[model samples]
Target: MSDDPYGVDVVACKSRQQRLLAEMVEHGLEWVVLTRRESVQWLTGAYVGPLFAPAAAMNTEGRVTLVLPSRKTSLTVAADEVLPYEEKWCSTLRDEQRAASNTVMMSALPIKLRHVGGEWSQLGPDLLADCEGNVINIEPTIFRLRRQKDNDELRMLRRANDANRAMYKLAREIVEPGVNELDVYNELHAVAVQKLGEALTYFGQDFRSNARGGLPRDRKIEAGELYILDLGVGFRGYYSDNARTLAVGGEPSAKQVLAWERVSEVFPLVESTVRPGASCKQLFEEVQSLLDKSKPWVFNHHLGHGVGLAPHEGPHLNPSWDDTFAEGEFFTAEPGLYHEELRAGVRLEENYVVTATGCEKLTDYPLGL
Candidate 1:
């Protein structure tokens, strides 16, 4: 075991590498190249932001691509935009052996920086071609391993939940008639930054109480309308996602009140059933059964989804999916009812982690109007 980087466990990272290597050995493959951003971030604790995106003219789809062989040989080819940060991050991880680095290519840009020299193989173009037929897709194996949260990952997830709750609390407080929907949207993120010391990676608001849902506009929020505010925060590379629908003006209509009541009752009931060996399909069906039958309950999306490194992970909460709950897996129980004709919707989403006995709610914000 080596020292951890920020919140990433080096030992756990190496274990993940070995897991992938074992998969490669089983398939008789020598190496696997990873181009997806999530894959690269999982392998290395290094994160490359949008500032590193390829220029529109460059036409390069590459971000931070990695070459991982069955053995110790590995390489990360960074995009030209964020090459400097990539270099420094690589060196930091390499110094502690957190990153496998046999060569450190110097930047040719005008900026002066010390070069950690070594030979680098030109593997990008060749690996991308996969002409040798040795490269295999790493997503299947890596994504399976990512579904469960380790202790270290849970710690970061907790922080993300805290930030998300803060944002939601602020959003609820400012949501009232006469306030512009855009004002609420912008302030949610601003307050999140003030509370979390960083801007959230995902923040969304929709004020279409009269419609199924629409993006926040300059139009002022009116009384007796339903609005949805979904939020997420990235902490130590982990993520937290939660959403809530609040009433805008005076007392909610009987129909609106009923929508919240049904979701409120169903959320806990569905969430409580999550445990190792529980079927995700059964849970989805159960939640659907709890919805009000008299009114139109249109759930545009799945019942819920696993949330972690990415917003949506595996063991998807869908009746069509046969996945069963597993210990250490995190998920969201988001049962929504969208009445398009009523032009209003009510959705209550909360994060949970499957446990040995049951599931634990990670986000504890109260559920109500």
Candidate 2:
């Protein structure tokens, strides 16, 4: 039995490498090195921690070489060749890991060509020196290509968001008066582990009570307070971003109900306005207009953002970046209002994948207040 957590499809990773090789050929580049944490995982499917960074070098001829710590050799990866370097062994320690990594990187990618394509900013000093200070930054191009979802990527993302559905249902059950937000956070984590049948590679986003959004605080939640749980979950390298809000007690004030109703209306509005080639900036402005005209409760945040390896990816529904929606892209639409008067406000978010016509919502939890 292959105990590969997250069920990473090796075939898909091979396709991703082919895509990058095509990109290198288009740019007239000989080789490309990827060292960014996300890039390493995206290309090779081996999750490296912050302490060490892995590098993937792909040639235009579809040859990919990965350099990672020797300890992680048992993990499955999608590289034609792997250059393993030492880090630590038994009780003894090796202080020469970085130097060893640099040496292997030099052997892995000895190209000092002028037309090199790689993540220039994320390079280690040793790897940077080997690139000869002329590596062109192709991060944007890679991110652009990432917007389109593959079947394997979608499968992994759905498994992650499925955990979100279970957690949100539990949130509705457990959020009540005098309950600590931290306790709720812990309970949700437990629910996720139960649902996924394994440990989560990532679980984040807001978990707070009587507040707009933040990490779960130690304070107890009062009855009439709003508890917002914006879930950002990761199964392997893929992530699912969605949110749900619950009234602390079973009962909600009239105004609180009204705020929930108004916030809930934004979802349909978003669904109708979103499609392939739709302007994200215009979508933000239009949605903001709808919420602004509704009075005191405000939608003061990015309307939505794409979800993938990074929680906040491109095709953003915000004014900062004028991105347009693309078919096969996964994203989130979050509309909210924060005020101590309405028991610290209400927010509702949903994850969706853009379809040929409109969008298919990934999260199916109840949207009740």
Per-candidate TM-scores read 0.75, 0.93
Candidate 1 segments whose C-alpha is farther than 4 A from its true place: 1-6, 51-125, 128-133, 205-211, 292-294, 340-343
lDDT of model number 2: 0.81
Q: Alpha-carbon error at 188 in model 2, in Å? A: 1.0
Q: How close is candidate 2 to the true structure, as a TM-score?
A: 0.93
What is the per-residue lDDT of model 2 for residues 105-186, given as tens digits with 9 covering 90 to 100?
Answer: 7786765655677676676566656454457888988898788777777888888987898998888888889989889989
Candidate 2 clashing pairs, residues 3+ apart or interchain? none
TM-score: model 1 vs. ground truth: 0.75
Tens-digit lDDT string for candidate 1 (167-222)? 77887778888898778767876776777676555554344444555567778877
Best by lDDT: 2
- Identify the runs in model 2 with alpha carbons over 4 angstroms from their true place: 1-5, 91-99, 130-133
